[model samples]
Target: MKPKKILLMGVSGSGKSLIGSLIAQRLAVPFYDGDDYHPEKNVKKMRQGIPLSDADRQGWLRTLNRLFVNNDEVVIACSALKNEYRETLRQNNEDMIIVFLRGDFDTIWSRHKQRTDHYFNGEDMLKSQFETLVEPTLDEAIFIDITHNAEDVVNAVMRALQN
Candidate 1:
């Protein structure tokens, strides 16, 4: 079945925003970046090289999930780093399809470093992200490599949804 909602998940530099936008445009659905939903406090924390504790994320996760509540035909780009976080996102949604964009540290770190205007800074934040990540199982998501070009990633996601 075609998922009513889709989530692109990964670390800070894993291309969630770029690819999510592409997929949403292709699907002709609304695209929401989870980063945009973060509270100022969370943004300030990450900007200062601080990793959010699960407690710190509770409200954020619930807020993201709320965006999905009673909604579908949408895509969201988020750093759903742990199982609990993913669960939070899935709270009211059974037709949510999550795509995990996996990439090597060096590759993603390089991308993060080259970014000019993003809030996430460098290796320190990247390290915290990886440390927090709990690789999703096949049952939970479709895993794609972030190394793939935008076209390839979008095509893959489309194909995956068709199946």
Candidate 2:
């Protein structure tokens, strides 16, 4: 069966929000951007170029996970940057579909550089994000290249969902 609960996960600049929003809109479901859910303290630390510790992310992860508690159709853009984070999200929702938007440093850096106004800065934090990410294997999630245009990436994710 096509998966319902969805998490579009990737590094900071890997198009999670853009693609997740598009997919959710097409699917006629509510879309949640995980960044908006970060606690103010976490944002403050990130703004000061401090990489958040696992402890710092715990509550936020729980908040996102709670979104899937009993919902049948939902899409969320999150950085599920660690194996544990994904596991936390998948706790009660075993069939949750994870879509990873994969891209290299230079590619992601370029996209981040183009952003005029965003809470998270570039490079330093980008490296931290990559350092934290434990990418899902073939059976764990659907992986798509973020090098493609927005529409194409969304199309790919949609097709993967239908599989």
The numbered model that scores best in lDDT is 2
Candidate 2 ranges beyond 4 A from true positions = none
**Taking the tens digit of each residue's C-alpha lDDT, what string does model 2 give over 129-161?**
998889998899999999999999989888888
The lDDT of each candidate is 0.88, 0.91
* RMSD to the hidden true structure, all candidates: 1.1, 1.0
Ten contiguous residues with the weakest lDDT in model 1: 113-122
TM-score of 2: 0.97
